[model samples]
Target: MSKTGPDFYDDEAVFATYQRHRQRVDTANDTLEKPVILELVDPVANKRILDLGCGRAMIGKEFLQQGAASYTGVEGSKRMVEAAIQTLTGTSGHVIQQTIEAWVYPPEAFDLVLSRLALHYVADLVPVFTHIFQTLAAGGQFVFSVEHPVITSCDRGWSAETRRQDWVVDDYFSTGVRVTYWMGDIVQKYHRTVEDYFYLLQTIGFQLEHLREARPQRHHFQDLQTYERRKRIPLFLILAARKAI
Candidate 1:
């Protein structure tokens, strides 16, 4: 079986480190991924929403506050699920502690399904995506972001200490489980190309609507240096697709 479920985040040290990063300003998730995802998932009012791998579910709270009809988050980590519950406290949000691969999709259920910087953890996308397709009502949108293929390709033969001026994108065509070192732990992430993601969704009966390689906008960033560094390479790939009516 392809390993799924809060593999690394279960580690207290790793989880703590990740939470710290999330709290920091100008991080990629705050500066690049969120802005792109939020724009792509606009007009959230009155939409039933599902969030996958919803770490802490801070974004889920935001969606609820934006007037989503209902919000459900599926998360794997026990710690994360607890934090997510706290985040959604006093809101119309429900959280399920399950991995994306294992969760059963309720057919034609949600108006919008969004995932942020997740999905790369799945060893396979076909089943997970098929579930998403089956769960979305006709005309419902699925918007998600993943670490860019160029960056995921660097799981091997790339050094983090390498100068920002250059990024070594090796094994672009070799797509599969990538062993990566992060926050003093070894983590496994699946790597897929831009074409891989597009074709997978297309094959699953989703009509592609929008695609973005997370580009930095001046207004979204407070520091000019962070903005310039983010511009060096696309750190995120966001896609929006709709189930045909």
Candidate 2:
């Protein structure tokens, strides 16, 4: 069985580390992904939003606060959905626990579909992309993030005790599932080159609007050490695409 289910994401430490501290701490996301996503999507009031892999309503809460019409979040982890519910009580959106790969979407339902740092776990994106295209209204937007190919393309090839964050990238063209360590869990994520992502989107007939290899701007990082290290390589990728009107 593929480990990319609710079980992979339900751990208390993982949720606390990634979802909860995402915006609070000046992690890679706060310095890079958030700024680009906000700039690219530019959400207006009363737009119906579908949040795929909506982890704990962190980004969903922002949409609701900014006056979204509705925010329906699809999350695989039951615990994440529960946490989202707690945060979204008396709010405009509700979360459902379902894997993005198999989750049934309401036809032509949303004005925007937003996913952050989630699709990497999906080993195959073809079916899910098709579904996302079908779920959006004509001219609707899809904004999403993934672990950058540079980061995903190789195994660290170092021992657990190795402190060096250096990455090796010998197998760039070979695409398949990659196992990575995070929060003491053996997490499985898919790896695809930048060209592969663009090609797949084009093949699915999604109009590419913006592409960003997430990099921190000047003074975006509080710690100089973190900033310098991140500047050497891309951490995340944001793609904004649209369906034809």
Candidate 3:
């Protein structure tokens, strides 16, 4: 059973689950996020960067490697933040253990803001995105990734016939709907539809530059089944948006 809530991440077992699949997850994320970052950012000797919901600091580490002037990470999970600190010990960035919604920052503090596989956890996204817009300098980019809403709405469990299907797992159109995961007890994830995402961005004065669906890599497919399934259905979404000047 999957664990739920903030506690879902704090538990040792949850951390171990991430640890066991760390290599695969990291490789996949790098393949998707790094290229986007490269395309959006030119190398600069000194540029202030902020990584929100920066679990484990993998993306922040990449920014440092690319010669960011300074980097700061906001992470909600204590365990993940500690791991990130340990991972980035010798690097030039600092990790703050706080939720993005509650973390305070001066306006226009960063030249670039980045996040990965986060944002959906927030039940209310308007304030979060608004804060991000306020935090970025003019022309600064906010690059982040979230679970594709289509994939989230689909039932994830394997079936004897199709393995996966577009059966609705939860309400896609409802506002403030709580999705209980792993037997409806372990974890709860909230979601807004694709339309909701775009609408929110429009309201916040962010111009959407790029959007892509990240399907599972071919290496993950053993038989033709999983490969075909992923090809037909994506598992994740990657997006990059910039604050209008």
- TM-score of every candidate relative to the true structure: 0.95, 0.92, 0.82
- Tens-digit lDDT track of model 1 for 77-120: 88899999999999989899999989999999999999887799
Worst 10 residues of 1 by lDDT: 155-164
Pick the winner on lDDT between candidates 1 and 3.
1
Candidate 3: which stretches are off by over 4 Å? 1-5, 25-45, 154-170, 182-185, 215-229
Question: Which stretches of candidate 1 lie above 4 Å from their native place?
Answer: 1-5, 156-165
Ten-residue segment with the worst summed lDDT in candidate 3? 176-185
lDDT by residue for model 2 (1-245), tens: 33674677787766666565565656777788888888888564888999998877877778889988989999999888998999898887799888898899889999999998899888789999999999999999999999899888886675544544777876888898887776556678899998888978889989998899977786788878777777888889889999999
> What lDDT is reached at residue 158 by model 1?
52
lDDT of 3 by residue, 22-65 (tens): 66643445544455555655464478888877778876777788
List ranges where model 2 is wrong by over 4 Å. 16-24, 158-164
Ordered from best to worst TM-score, the candidate numbers read 1, 2, 3
Against the unseen true structure, what C-alpha lDDT does each candidate score? 0.88, 0.84, 0.71
Note each model's CA RMSD in angstroms. Answer: 2.1, 2.0, 3.9
lDDT of 3 at 73: 91
Cα error, residue 44 of model 1, in Å, equals: 1.3
TM-score quality measure for candidate 2? 0.92
